[model samples]
Target chain A: MKENKCCCSKKQKKLKVVNIGLQTFAESLRAQGVTVAQVNWRPPRKLDSEMKNILDDLL
Target chain B: MPVKKVTVQQNRYADSVTLMGILDAVKKSGKVMLAEVQMGTPQNVEVMRKLGFDIPATVNANDLVIALEAQTNELLDEAYKDVIDRLDRKHTDGEETFNSIDEVDPADGWNLCQISLPGEYAAEEAKKAINKGLDVFIFSDNVSIDEELQLKRLGDEKDVLVMGPDCGVGMLDGVALATMSLVREGPVGIVGASGSGAQEVACIVEKAGSGISALIGTGGRDLYPQIGGLSMIKGIKRLCEDDQTKVIVLVSKLADRAVMDKVLTFADGVKKPVVAIFLGADESLFASHKVHGTFSLEGAALKALELCGISCKDFEISDEKIKGIVDSYMKKFSPQQKYLRGVYCGGTFAEESLIYLKEHNPDSQLYFNMATKYARKLDSHLKSQCHTLVDLGSEEFTIDAPHPVFDPELRLKRFRQEAQDPETAVILLDFITAPGVHEDPISPFAKACAEAIKARGGALAVIASICGSVNDPQDIVKCGKELVDAGVILTGSNHQSTLLASAFMKALDNRK
Candidate 1:
């Protein structure tokens, strides 16, 4: 993280974002001029696991 | 002289990517000078070929067409394969892979985490993110009071902000965090407990030539004694301390007495002026609380703007203007055309219309779906009464298909149904333009409304408001003009549209 002072004496923080759900939320962050990486989250399920494996194999 | 035109079509459907490649290939190949590679069905190819004859006898059109057609066929085959191969090699899951917030920081580099996981997993995810020392904006609903309390406390320990588990709208430093309008950067900072309420305030403030410093949406239940107005309190403090914020505005429907008391005490301590909207609460509630209280969302926005030395008078609808339109529409409406039907694309739009209409004309009863959040007490929402409003975005309407905002087909069908009804003298609608929304949303409904009007002997009044700015990609001006050209009375704002709608209904109701 690059060195940036806190806006207040509250906390030191960076501006990068991890959007861990809805694509809509991530899109908003990007629109707002934030560096956001959206996590493609799905429930931990057998079907998702199988789908993930298939997706992994596709690579 | 030679005429040139390149028309290409895949034996199968060529996706946009493949079509673009074919154009690029033709562009890179200097042989086809001034060539335009078009991707279309075989029908378009036949049309192109027929149009090729019009290139004038002075030019060798036949030779150019023959060469271009051959080149196009070759490019189509190669381009199609390249697209298919590229897509085959790409794994979407692999591209989006990240199991935990911990893996995100050093790799992807994000200091803030917006959590929208299910309520059950929300607290855990928030804790993990907070421990990683990131500000959290939670958009998850159904989170328990205990879980929310725990998550927020953890965020405090980490010395960062925790917005909400049900918060849907927030804008920090010109970035609309979740559900919000494209508000500009300015001095009025907002902290609201209602998503739609905050959105209305932000949008109205933006439209009034002023702008927002920030808009923080605390979750709907943040003011409950159990949750204890945690985020709202934090939001106020943050806005008060921020150098950019010249004024602070607070909006909420339900404020527990104890929480409101505590919040008022807190607001009194802040130096910046505060505008508070407690929907059902009296203005006297803030008399001793060091705040200005307004009842409605529109009033809240106007009040906030006023504190910062701006006046917003557009929400007020003049009776003369209302009377002229009412009388004009009243003349065309037949005896059978009596009822008013509103089909809204958004939940907030529907509620605002209903609230405005009810406040203006107390006798105008409205029926809404049971799925709406407006009635927390819950009506059998199964059926609608005479003057009904349906939020097309409600779960009941969006169960199988996409929300009508993206796909207006469902809303169009409903509009047609209402328009065809003999009693539907007025058909009210809302058009929202945002990124990812259907570009030409109004034209379909415009055609639908026109047809319905024709069926009704050209008597139905279509009143609508477009909820968008020109900055949005939907080309709202052109789209709104389309609605107007189709004989829709398009209002400048949702509040104006509601007044017009209610005025028409009241005038019609009085006649009966």
Candidate 2:
């Protein structure tokens, strides 16, 4: 749906992972010498359909 | 008297993984005897209530609940503040953190996203990652089927891989992801719907002197008709086109009849040698197709090894050797001990053992927590019935806390329970060692086994297999040694361990 801005041309490089929701997966990858960005993901607050639509339009 | 307190944070929610970490930290402070940090889901509220916490009736699923017990109200308050502090702590030990996928800037060469959030939120995050051209490996479970279909469809249209809504084990470009062991890079690639099934095969392949090019997990439901084996087909095609992968192995429990046909037909077209293990499927299903079909994990591993031009005769124990081992164990059993109980942390291992035991002893009644055609469902997972195989990784066991692979307390308790049963002649177990699991999962269970054997006057037999490699962080060789030193019979593979347990059961039946 969006342009692939994250695509890397180098295929032989070490894998880069963005681990969301569970720091352990990121830690495990980092322990193995892989490059990882840990995301401290928490559940989003509840929004009704009308509020969600407004937010979606605003964003 | 210990004081118990329940505090609910309205509209504040964290993933179970994060809550588990907070729970551990609070308990380790030694200020609280009983502490639980969980979302206020019905099941979690029920668990807290059972633990003697008085949760408010107004608490809802979106709310965060922290229950604590301590010697005094002061101690309880201190521990409660510690949990809140940990929750408010933003940075995780100097590692860079992002609030959402939008902040992750894909140009940093981030090619993949591994999501382990709660099921309700997993799909939206996965959609964001996929839209950003990042391949996804989801470890979260409980996502609705409609959400899974929508995500897979989006992934298909985007051409980026979607690994799972409940996917656990995976390895890409020589890096183990999620709960997978660190397997060496080599010729074999796997497309599996079952996490533990693929892990077993990968470990067995490594033990057979072969290695893996990739291990792609398609979650547990990808092969159902609703999903149409979307991820599995994509994975098979990707492995087929990859230069490093010379052989492809497909592993899963039996899918819908039409879906199985569709997948095998697709695999049949691939030029590379393919091995399929549709557990409980008749062997004849593969006779018509060019792809090889196997019924057991070991059989699938050996077949893939053979296709790779590797001789794995040493990996297989002769029937005579199995008989000798069985005879030795049978002599130690008392006249009253007759049944076998398998307490497994890996679900696939339990299913494999249940299938094997049922095949050999068709007349014997078998029970499992997960219902199968051959085995009836256990009345209660907390208590093992005769000839029971329990998958402690199932949702029933994992709803309150982390998986048994990460915390062995549940399996250990079940092991002790089964060990004390007078009718349990053989107790079967499977231990998985990987990046994210417990450091030494075998020793505590081994110690418990030793005590149980001593208590039984050496009349009990404990048989187990470890699914890991020498490259894992845990000392696997030492783990095996711990089991042996504790009078536990250790096997090289889960299949062999199950076979030995089955043989012991058959022998006990004959003696009766």
Candidate 3:
């Protein structure tokens, strides 16, 4: 899986990565002050755990 | 003894007869007089009868010959009204028929309006309707850019929707409507610079048994540096936010790599593969990402389906046939005739032709700029000689008329001139016709092309490409064959035409 930040518009500032769990990408993006969501079928566990950890750190 | 060709005015309307039946009647009867078939509903038949034309049980050759000389406008109007009226009464999928815009709620989904209104009326009327909060669906070709920009700006400010100035196929809210609605919905969403390219992708996805979530058309405007893909960028972002969309597809004839990279950077984070197919560009720029770049429009569709793991029924031309056509054309062509001039209806086709020319002759100069200001960037020598690629979609070309697709006359005039130029050896063109195309385009177009070839003494070779249905293939085949008989070569797909043109040029050099 490759990781990159959202660069489409000036207003958007989120880090997004694919082939990883939606939770992880969303969490990273959200931390960067960007809204995040996933529109796919599967979400992996390890990536989901990383997202949960990031959320905890933010809290 | 000698015979003179006499013109007879005939009008025949046959309500029911197989094509073969009509052909047999015409053949037995001799040169056509005028044939008019009223494929209308029973109520419409009543309406047509009220309009005062004789509604015959079957058309005769005498009537067809007369129709050839008689005014076609009145006959065509009657024909259109007949179809609309029939559509009003017919029920599909056991659903009740709904007539007029008042019957359907505009807020529920896209309030589609396909404007084939002539001249300035289409743009003017579409603007009027769009101002009234209507979701405008445009199918007309040759609409002015200024008019389109005004409509687009209005759509942006008023929260009203405007799909295209020349846009074709699209799916809205899971409902397939508009031109080239041949795809089933899948997790993929697409934004295309060309209408046919968009429709082709959707069809490919459907063949894989997958459907499209959203297929946005940026028309030919979005990728031009001035347009900078503004609406497309908006649509992409919106689809990315949608919960149903998984993969995204971006296809265009051309894109500024710098602008594309911005979208690419965003797509890289989406957790899904983004298939980018910019037809005329070299794909080496996107070599790093999961992005799969494709040369041909159909090839992009195939790759997108494959990456999605969708099972696609093979639809595009086979690789062997593509190579064979190229090789054969090359062997027969002379290299000394190297320069190419394209008078195209589709912007993408012209772009593809230039790419082919540039690839073959790296030193070749191209005079193309999406912006009027940058228009000076074009090779002045080529531009002056009309050897430059003239997209009928541009404002300069459409000022007097819309486009060669809808109004082939002006382009044909320019094409004839270019064909005779000693500097020009090849001319590429797009002859598009589909179900919703302008009535009776082929015969007039074929006749013009024949005259041009005859004038040039076949000094210029042409490659005509078409976008139409396979079920009714004869229209293009007939046009292609006619041009071929007149000493001009023709092919069906843009890729095939480009490959053949390139191979021919390359082979000519080898002979040297």
Which stretches in model 3 have alpha-carbon errors above 4 Å?
Answer: A1-59, B1-169, B173-189, B194-214, B219-247, B253-259, B279-288, B308-338, B365-388, B421-424, B445-460, B471-492, B508-512
Please, what are the lDDT tens digits per residue for candidate 3 over residues B1-512?
A: 21112122233222122222443443344333333333333543454455444445443332321111123455444433443343222223242223223333334332334443332445765665566555555655577777777777776665544666666655544433344443444677887767877765665565445667777776666555555565566557656765566677887766677767666666666766678878766766677556667777656766777776765545545557656755654444444454566677766666666666666655444445344321223443225332356676566667668566656677777776676666666677776654334434456656766776666555556777665433222355565566677666666467667776665455444445
- Which predicted model would earn the best TM-score? 2
lDDT assessment of candidate 3: 0.53
Error of 2 at A12 (Å): 2.1
lDDT of 1 by residue, B1-512 (tens): 43443422222222233335555765464444343333343543455556552232322211112114224545544544543454333224243445566676644455667887657667878888888777788888878888888887776666667888788767665566654556666778888887766766776777677778877777777788887777777788778777778888898875798888788788888889988877657556877887887766667778887888887676556778888999988999877777788888877667777766766677665677754333322254333457888887888778877889778998888888788777888988987765545767878988887777777776888898776655566666787778878888887667777788888888888888
| Model 1 TM-score, all chains together | 0.73
For all predicted structures, in order, the TM-scores are 0.73, 0.86, 0.53
Q: Write the per-residue lDDT of candidate 3 for residues A1-59, one digit (tens) a residue.
A: 00121222222323221111112222323333432222221111223578889989999
Off by over 4 Å in 1: A1-14, A23-33, A38-59, B1-99, B104-109, B255-258, B371-384, B436-440
lDDT of 1 by residue, A1-59 (tens): 12321222112324567877665556656665666775644333224478889989998
RMSD (Å) per prediction: 12.1, 4.5, 18.3
Worst 10 residues of 3 chain B by lDDT: B1-10
Clashes by residue pair, model 1: A16-B110, A16-B111, B370-B381
Candidate 2 wrong stretches, greater than 4 Å = A1-11, A40-42, A48-59, B1-13, B20-94, B377-386, B395-402
Q: What's the DockQ of model 3?
A: 0.01
